[model samples]
Target: MADIDVLRDVAPGVMPAYRALVASGELYSDAAQGMAAEKLQSLWVKLRGYDPQPKAAGQNGWVGKLLRRKQVDEAGEHPNGLYLVGEVGRGKSMLMDLFFAAADVPRKRRIHFHEFMQETHKRFHKIKADPAVSDPIPPLADMIAAEAALLCFDEFQVHDIVDAMILGRLFEALFERAVVVVATSNTLPDDLFKGKPGRDAFLPFIALIKKHLDVLVLEAARDYRRERVQGLRAWYVPANRYADAALEEVFGELTAGVPAGPESLYVSGRKVVVPLAANGVAWFDFSALCGVALGPGDYLALATHFSALLIDGIPRLSPDNFDEARRFVTLVDALYEHRVKLYASAAALPDELYKSGEGAAIFERTASRLVEMQSEEYMRLPHLT
Candidate 1:
């Protein structure tokens, strides 16, 4: 048996919690095995030197020395912060899991970026309404601090105005209480708050991040997701006679044991109601289901909703069908965020979705996003020989 299997068999009870934590991605396996503290320190040093794979000879170099200092400080009273930036699937999340698992801290929580922002917004609104709240800011700050000494966030990207506005203050409060933050993102810190018309107002927050966290770039361009399934055939389910029944089965499995309300269901604060037309065909509104307006509490509520989706109305949308396209984008984002499996039916493949139009750019981006939603490998699939 493998070492992990052996470890599991030898200590089944203790291993169960560790396995559960790792499986839930709240803890990293390396950390559970007591290797992340050292590995993370080395990884941090290598990242600083622009080396994805550091050489044995350079293990004791200046970067290495700096890493040792950071590790020592992190292990001490002053919690250290780490920021990992890279393209999707370059092991950023995995590395974060390792670091989070390895940290000896008592209180820790790892949450997806979308879910975290949603939760923060939910809590903010709750505190706003309560008169007995008594100094909302400090109490709120203390609450997060008490709940988590270390906060590890995955898929950390800032594209919306609401998130941009409060992220600084939120981080500032957490940092003030010496909460260590480890985050992974596809974009660099400088590129994060960019392009917004009034982004200048967020400059102080940018400075605060630079001051509090040690930023590291994982520059390897190779897509780890691609590497994992280079030779695997794409999974495709064509719309057919049995498609609806199969889709319903998948949906039933996802929503099993949950109470039924409207044919449409609401997950998280976001609505997942299935709007039916006069013909009785089931459809859904993505924007209402998963948007930044909702919070983590909403997602927690949604977790029990549906694990898979089957939407049959997708086709080559036109300018007249902009609403449909927008809804599709929303569904794509929700599925990606929740890591839910999906089987969709479009009148044509993504490439053929936009045949010709002046609005081709919008269609192209949407189509690309849809393709990505289906399978990242589909983006690189070779045309039929």
Candidate 2:
């Protein structure tokens, strides 16, 4: 590990770098977002030379069980981390990204909270399956702490009871090993897992968070993400060159700075190849999706992975093509349920798209949702995975 002073000399402070970006017009300046950034800057400064390695205290003289025990005992050695709370579109994620990028610590990681929990459960199962290991939680915590001394989680949430039960012990042990956690959540720490079954058992985890992390509530009059979603020119009628050009622009805007590439996701042992993807935005053609025989599970998987979706084509529908129209309805339902942003160039407006289909009555709800999705209110709802 680098010495504390050495890291301090080399690491550019977060606030100045952020202001520089704003001055250069790379990021718009906002007080609420900047406040959270300042708090992150404080944590950034405090994390220097704080090592999460099991042998951080050295194994020179006492190189066995004593050394390992010493690592867990020194939980008070590092500065407290930060927990940022805010509304869905209030730039909580953006601030998390900024802090993580500017953090000059070794073995740091930034990941979506849902994805992390999924992997955590998987890791726990693997550890449990190993007959050699008696207790899995401590080892799992040690492994995670060793990998990411500084962990940043975006959209920290507790939707599943299984995850809720595991987090308390896992995070408690991780904290003891000098792992610094910075997380962004839409819910306040006290409010997490509230009203869920077994929530009383989850109380200690909330207390542990309050003890180890400085909680900051971020608020802004303008919802930046909602504005971005509202500005979108979505749901065009009678697909033409104009709609094509508009969708291309939307793709460019959403995927700016992120490289465009192909991605493949597996659902139920089946492969779904995304023609183009960058960041959490996916671009697909209507033929590639509804034209092919895909079920609700496939659509759900796509909706789960992508925060925003841009479909390029949709032919007008009737009883002649009820199958595709039904598929379209399923796709829209998945997208709506997940709060995914949608952009498409279709042959007709959503209302007129499938008016005469066998299931067009059901399609009406989809059309209504399609129109509702474009509204600012709908756009402000957070994307659910």
Candidate 3:
């Protein structure tokens, strides 16, 4: 652990660096963001000499036990971390990324909130399989604490009751172990488990968050992402080489030239491969999403993992391919519910995508949603994933 002054000397502050970057026209400047970054920088300083290691094995003696108790008593006083809340594209995740990168903490991790919860669920299930392990939360928290003294979560959200039920216990253990957490979310702590069944049981977790973190609202008025897509076409008709080229260009621009590659997701123990993915955007052929056998669950899972989806070659549908058309409807419903931005090169306009089909009645609703999704209003809605 370096001395506080040494840490300060090594890292001047996040705001100064942030200002320089904004001045270089590399980042959008916001005063609210600067305040949050400054606070994160202060936290970085506080974390310099902070260590989360447990006492040595030989320190079980009475004097060592007394010293350990004192250490435990002082752990909570280490530092209060940050909880940043804002609308989508308000730069919450980007600023947190900058903070995580600039911080010199020895044990730190940055992960998407959904991915973190997915890993947590997997670990819990694995540990619970052993009947002898009565309590899994503490062990899980210990495992996380041993690896990351600082845990930064991006796009923080809670949708599953199982995750909600365990978070209080898991986080309590982590806080006791002096594991600091910084997270960015579109929702406030109080509204995290809103409208969910068994949400009453999740209130304690919300209270835990309020007690441990400094809640900051990043009220940046600009939606940077929507701005990037404002004038660009979101929907393309007559799926042709021109539309194909436009989709490719938009995908590349949104992902900042990151090469797209194959991505697979496990939904209910079945692997669903994405043909192309970069950053948090996924791309797929029409058959990959709708022409194949799939259900609402798979679409819901996809909605939870991606910010935007681009589908290519959506064909016109009739009774002969009603099943595929039905699946497409389900996929659109899921994406719309999660407020995921959509880009597609379809055989025709949304209203003309399905006609003279047994499923055409419901496809009308899907068509309506497709139109709404392309609107600036829908694009401005925060993505749940």
Candidate 4:
């Protein structure tokens, strides 16, 4: 793809670069995705150190209309930003990645939303530690705004109350500093943090998002992620090389040619590494997840980020390793709640996995979920981000 910095001053913009990919058969044209690209093209041109000025008196019609946002903004001014919303596999992240890389802005950052919030928390913690630091948010926001004038976020969703509360004030300050934001999410602006505990306290953040960012829904005619997951066996028993091969196929199909690599997920400022991850699918050994001392937060973060999980070698549960057994159950609960596609190679069938143990009863419920996940109904369900 031609750099948007060149596309910025030149005639050919982001849309033409997208078309070149289509012509080369690397991508297929979708009107919905095209519209999103156009919107991004508008941003790509204007964000290259372009200083927008306050409109003079009587500056009306198309240019004036473009200067001030309607519906999403009541403050009469909004920074350059967009919030892309759609179901999975609409190419939201792909387009955002292109724009982020190609945007001419020198000070820019692209990050997963959770990681951004985690980093923010870390910064806040350090600032709060200083006795003289009466308020941390203002200076913190200034530093962030200066560092990344343009911020691109992948998979923007809030699952924690701590993040929820901090976002309102933090973003308000970021917007005040003219830090542009572009984010992608599976949920709508209204539905973010919906029905979560302490959701009422998070409403202000929702309002601020709607106020500052234009929400664009990328509607695509082609979404094969459901079909892709359906083709794979959700649970494979008698862990063997054949089962491993099946999982390899599943990972390939899910990621759609994205290169696999080790992924470190941050939970409460700690890193939980996945052996291999690409797109929204993560691959891990059962021991890596269960044998390790990971809590509900780690499990929840894993469930939230990945749409599909491939776990290798889930051994039979016993009283000897009840802690791992319990963690396995917790992991299953988180995955089921988020409707993540679970593919695993196990030593035995769910019911037979735990023969006799104090944690056997708990395994039964997870077993039932494993069975249900393989059903046609479950295969059709959308992964909740």
Better of 2 and 4 by TM-score: 2
lDDT of 4: 0.80
Which stretches of candidate 1 lie above 4 Å from their native place?
1-77, 132-135, 235-266, 269-385
TM-scores of all predicted structures = 0.54, 0.84, 0.84, 0.80
Give lDDT tens digits, candidate 2, residues 106-184: 6799877876886788889999999998989977986787788889987788878899889999998887667778888
- Give the worst 10-residue stretch by lDDT in candidate 2: 61-70
User: How displaced is residue 89 in candidate 2, in Å?
Assistant: 2.4
Q: What's the best-to-worst order under TM-score?
A: 2, 3, 4, 1
C-alpha lDDT (0 to 100) for residue 222 of candidate 3: 85
The lDDT per prediction is: 0.53, 0.78, 0.80, 0.80
Clash totals, every prediction: 7, 0, 0, 0
The positional error of residue 346 in candidate 2, measured at the CA in angstroms, is: 0.8
| lDDT (tens digit, per residue) of candidate 3 on 196-257 | 99998899999999988999999886887777666779888889999899898778756643
Off by over 4 Å in 2: 1-11, 55-75, 264-272, 292-294, 318-323
Question: Could you tell me which residue pairs clash in candidate 2?
Answer: none
